[model samples]
Every structure is written in C-alpha cells, then in structure tokens.
Target: MNKLMLILLALSLLCPAIVLAKGDVNLTAPAKDQALTKLLMTRHSVRAYSDKALTLDQLSNILWAAQGINASGKKRTTASARATYPLQIYVMVKNVTGVDPGIYLYDPQNNKLTPVPKGEKRTSVVPDAVKQDWVAKTPAVIMISYSKPEKDLGDKTLMFVSVEAGAVMQNVYLMCEALGLGTCAVGGYDAKAAKEFFLLKPGEEPVLMLPIGIPAPAEPAK
Candidate 1:
C-alpha cells in the first residue's frame, strides 16, 4: 500500500468534506508584534464592509492569525493530543483582491488555500445561519469543521478540538482588533444545513462561522 492509498483509506472512514484545489500562499501580516491586547479589546463585530476589497496579504494575515503555522514546526496556535490539530479552516471570501471570490480551505501543512467552488461558500452556509445578513454584509467569513476523533480517545478528543478552535478564534479577534476590522462568531447556525451545503461526509461536521469586515462608521455622538 502506498501513501495515497493510505490517505484514501483513512478518508474513506472519515469522509471529509469536498476540498478545494491547492494553490500558492499569500502572506499578509508583519512578521512580529502585529498588535497588543488593549488594541484587540476594542475590536467589535461589524456588519458592513467598505467596497474597497481586501488585499491577499490582509486575508493571509487574518487567516494566519487564526491558525497559521509558527515556530518552524509547530502551528502558530497551541493544540492538544499529540498536535492532531483536528480543526480545518475555511475562508468564505466575498471581495478579496486578486483571488477569485469563493470558499477556500486553508491547509496549514502547506500554507496554501484550496478553492472549493465558485460561490459555494456564500450560498451554502448563509441560509443556515440564524444571522443571515451577516453572510452577505461581511466581506469574508471563517468556517470551522472538526476531524473525526481518534478511535477510543472518546469525547475528550472533541474537547481538545474545541480548545484548539477557541484559541484560534481569539487570535482572529485580536488580529481584527489590531487591524481595525469587525468580526463575530456564530455557532448557532444550522450545522446540518451547512454540512449538506459544504457537501461534507458523515464524519465532518460544520461547527463554527465567523463574519469579518470593516465596521460601518459610528454616527456622531448625540
């Protein structure tokens, strides 16, 4: 048995969602000291975005902040259970410069984004979310799904994935704060609706969604 066959065997059991085609990586954020905590505290979820599209670099930085690889070998964020790092990051990009607008799966191992399908991200997950406006208003969103737990590891493994995702989500919040972006996490969406939308198989479950964009300006203090 070869590597590809092994992967196929594993996938047969897991039935991961439809994947995007892999492509070159775009790095957005500065190498270090991107922002401080106080600055991130001011970050809030914005419903409107500027018509001006986000640059690839900006998108890259935001995704990186969420769960990019760091320290040469390990991921930028911490994970438990032998670094299984079960959560996958998908970007539903509406108006990014240079890149085609669509749903993209982020591959941390390769630092690449794979295109799932044109318009799939927007349509598939939007209707399932309780806050439907958010899917349209924000220029981008982050979608999270988990890998099947290792056999006999039990429910504890699910908690591990949750912890890893929480850290990544906070990182995204902090980065948005520093970058003057708006974001909100929504877990109350129709998971089954979204799962079918993403064309996920039995083992993959859509767990979280985050809408991100520039906040509309505040009205004058009155």
Candidate 2:
C-alpha cells in the first residue's frame, strides 16, 4: 500500500470515533417512498439558474445536507481526527428568502448561519475559478475551508480533512437532487480571491466552492 494509505489505515485503527463519523447520513426530504432514483437520474450540473430566490426551508435543507450535524450534540455530520472537524462552510448569499444577501458562516455549534459581510453582493467575490460566468449568475456560493488540524498530526491531517469535505460535498449534491435545486462543485477557484472575499484567517484556507440556484430552463433554438 502507498504511504498515505498506510498512514490512513493506522490512523483509523487509532481513532475509531473519527472513522465512524465518516458514514453517510441519509437525506430525510423526498423520503424513501418517493424513489429518489428519479432525482438522481435527473441530477445535472446546472450553470444557469433562475432569478427567483430560495425559501428558508430549502436553504436549511441544503446546508444541512452539506455538513449539518447528524447527532443533536455532535459538531459534524462526518468524523474528524480527535474530532477536529477542521472544515468550515461559508455561504455567500446573493438571494434567498429571509436571509439578507451577504456572506455567512454556518455554525454547527449553534445550528445557525451567522451573517458575515451583509448587504450588497460584490462583483469580484472570487476573481479566481477562472472567472466562470456561473459564479455571478448563481444566487449563492458555498465555500469550504479547512482550519489547520493540530500541526503535530502532520500532512496526514490534510488528507483526512479533504476526505471529510468530499463526504459533505456528496451530501450537498444528494440534497440538491432531492430539492430540485442546481449545484456545481468547483475546484478551479483562486484561493487568494476567496480568502479575501471571506476575510479568512491565516489557518483557515479556502479549498472548494459550490455555486447553487434553480437552474434556468434550456432555451429553444430558433
């Protein structure tokens, strides 16, 4: 096995609480009887979304899907080494019902989204991501960041944090599938731009960004 794989295995053996926390949390919406298979089949990476804003419940459901705590008392939906759960999810809201437009931080501890830079949307929120048009077209963007795991853990900590982020991303996608919302996971972003946009701290580094909305319908060619 590769060195990283061996390290991961050793860590898993040493930390079971963190390992079990990585399991999937089944989505509650759309329910089991509704045949989520249909939603999965229709799921697509939508780049163009409608101008309409999302309702509170929709917003809550999607955020929960991304990284909502599974247990009432737990801090993360997925596990972390020493329960580090180093990742942070930031919501950049351009339009959503009840939620004033601005960047917000999802605090699993309080089960609430705390507003950051509230009010108007910034045009250059993220100059990176290759300046993809979808960034501006979408009403909201979710940014993932990792707070440095105990440096004593070494580079292994980064791998663990990344794996945890993957699970959270899947949760977001599945929830979007159930809710009829559109989402696209992006990694080609300018980390510097995102860091500035959120005013991230030294230890907090932006890793991924997902822009979401109700996709605009495909236009008919004349």
Candidate 3:
C-alpha cells in the first residue's frame, strides 16, 4: 500500500471511525443539529402576520409538506394509519399571487388546487373562526378536513382522524417556519360555522384551521 493507505490504517486502529472513507461523521448529531432540533427550537405559534402576500410556489410547498406525495407511489409526508389517507385540505385563497380568491380543494395525487365553487356570502371566514381578526388579516388559511368513511377506521375513527390531523398541522408549522412565514392552529373556531363557510358535505368533518401569513417582525430568530 502507499504512504496514505498506511497512515489511514494506523489511524483507524487508534480510532475506528478515523478511516478516511468512514471519517468521524457524527451522524445523529448532524441530523438533529441540521434538521430536527433547529426547526423544533425555532418553531413557535405565530398568530400575528404582516400584510405581505405569499407566492404560489410558497403556498404549493406548504401544502405539499402537509399532505403531498413525496415518497414512492402514494406515500405522503406523514404516516397514515392503515394508509387510509383520510384528510382533505382546503385553501382559502385571500392574497396568494396568481390564484383567484376562493376555497380550493388540494388534490394531493394530482398536485393541483381544484376551486370549490361556492356563492360569495356577505360575511367572510372571520366570523366562522369566532371573529379572530387575524384570520381576516392573513393572506390564506389552510383548513384540514376529513371525509372518509367510518368503516375505514372502525368505531375509533375520530380518534385516528384527530391524531392524523395533528401530524398534518405539525408539518404545516415546520414548513411555514422554514419558508419564513407564520401560522397558528385555531381550534377555537365554531366547527358548525366552519362547515357552513367552507361548504362541507354531509359526512365531511372540519378538523382544524391554520391561519398562515407573513409574520410581522415580533420575535427575533432563536
């Protein structure tokens, strides 16, 4: 062997991870430090937002992170119980560029937003979200809904659906943080009112609402 090979072998004997090809790459630390921990440490619920508008790309990425098909075939960002994939996402487009103002169903498989045609009412989503002024101010609100059959999840359907919805929102929160945006989970809204505002079907259930927007400069990055 050459001089470099001999040196590498000697170093590997002293420190097993010292081999040049298998250098001391603290894999676990790198993962948490670079990815998970950074996001977790910085992630905060942002209810206040600026008047800035979000581009279509930003909205698309956020939606994809929430429920897009990222993996091979139908696998998504989050784990679905029994692959039921019960969640449906609806975007209330208020200030997104290039998209009209309306509630659009997110078609994950096709990666497109199909506009949910509904008559414009006198009142907006503000009242449905218990009159949270921020909801009206934000550029967009992502509503996570469920319309799967109960038989897929048995009698504990609500429980599973709730758990799954939590995952979806967590994905949204992280994605928003990464995109320099802000969002908050609003469970205080009237579910019945949300159903009417979003025009839900008989069996479709509204689970959670995420009011997303450009956060006003309040807290500095940690």
Candidate 4:
C-alpha cells in the first residue's frame, strides 16, 4: 500500500524466506532460523522459576548470549556504540552445575568467568533490589551494569549505551527461549541502591536485572 510495504511485497515475491507473516513482519525468521520464527512467537516473561540448577553448558550459553565474544573473537553477540562495549555482566550464582554460589564477572574476551572478590556475601541484597523474594531462589540472576565513568560518557553518550544494553537483554530473552529456560527482565529499581547491591565501583551504575532458570510447571486446573 505504501512505499515500504510495496518494497517488502516485492522482496517477498523474490525470496522464499520473506513470506508474509501474521501480526508483524519481524516475526519472520531468516532462512537459517526457522526455529527462531516459533521461538519469537512463544517467547514470554517467566517470573516463577524452578530451583533446579542449570547444566554448565546451559549456563555458559546464557552468558554467551548476553555478552559472549563471537567466533571471530573480535565482535560481540550484541552491537556496541563505537565498539565501546561498556556494559559489564555479573552472575549471581545461587545454583549451577560445577559453579560455586558466588558472583562472577563474565569475561567476554576469554569466555571464562572470574569470581568477583568478596562477591559471595553480597547476594543477600538481590531480593531487595528486585523486590521479589522468589529471586533468592532462582538459579542465577544476570546483572548488566554500566561500568564507564559518567563524565566521560555524558548524557547523550549514555543514551547509546542504554540502547546497547537493551540489545543485550533481547539476546538473553531469545537464548533463554531456545534453551527451554525462563527469564524476566526487571526495571524500576533504584540506581543507587542497585549499585550498592552489586558492589559496583564509584563510577559504575547498574542498568538491568534478569532472573533466569527452569520455569515452574503451571498449576493444574482444580
């Protein structure tokens, strides 16, 4: 009907992968990601999670989807403004296969997690930060925070950083869906309080919180 829609129709006629989709156009996955079409449709927020611990592979993939460096070893899974990937990912590991209960920093460069010094004792603050008691029982909480100094990034630059962080969250959502795990992105937390909760440095600021684990089965009908 319009210029953009007409272009899409022409493309659909040319490419089998560009078939018409219900609801929205982006729901159509590319040729390689047929499963992704279904995954995108079914993805939903999962708040109530089972206490079962995740396998090492599953845990690794979740973190990788968040900020793992790609096979190229030069670019990350998510986009960064000017390649300045300033978001730091921390794992509040209450339960996981082989990994001990502690807070670990995701080293995207090496694809290994390093324990955050004195991080084990700081997790009691999570329940308060997320304002949910059930988070205390979730297997892991992925914490994304802005680590660059505010003065250097400034207000406008931080806008780009926030957009970058959002892309990271979307990747996590899709990854969790594909792995049969569940996750929910949480906002509305007090930045100062969340910063203290993560034990961040003076200039670091917390951005987003994600609680991920196996979804609890729905209650049976009475």
Compose the digit string of candidate 4's lDDT tens values, residues 1-222: 899999988898898566746554544435555787778887788877777988889989999999999877789999887688888998888778898887888999989998887787455545457666767767888889887743465567879888988998999999999999988887856677777667676677888888888988871222
Q: Candidates 2 and 3: which is better by lDDT?
A: 3
What is the C-alpha lDDT profile of model 3 across 1-222, one tens digit per residue? 999999988887987666547444734344655776778778888867788888999999999998999868689998888888888998888888888888888999999998887823212588745578877878888889998754567888888889999999999999988888888898889988898787777889899999889988874453
Reference-based lDDT, each prediction = 0.70, 0.76, 0.83, 0.81
Candidate 3 lDDT for residue 139: 86
Candidate 1 global TM-score: 0.73
Using Cα atoms with residue i matched to residue i, what is each candidate's TM-score against the true structure?
Answer: 0.73, 0.75, 0.81, 0.79
Q: Which segments of model 3 are wrong by more than 4 Å?
A: 1-32, 119-123, 219-222
The 10-residue segment with the lowest total lDDT in model 4: 22-31
* Residue-wise C-alpha lDDT for candidate 1, range 102-191, written one tens digit per residue: 778887767788887544535335665554664566777788788776554575877777877888778888878777776777887887
lDDT for predicted candidate 4 compared with the true structure: 0.81
Better structure of 1 and 2 per lDDT:
2
Best by lDDT: 3
State how far residue 92 of model 3 sits from its true place (Å). 0.3
Look at candidate 1 and give me any clashing residue pairs.
Answer: 28-57
Between which residue pairs do clashes occur in model 2? 21-79, 129-189
Ranking by TM-score: 3, 4, 2, 1
Query: Candidate 3 at residue 143, lDDT?
Result: 86
User: How far is 10's C-alpha from truth in model 1 (Å)?
Assistant: 69
| lDDT of candidate 4 at residue 13, scale 0 to 100 | 82
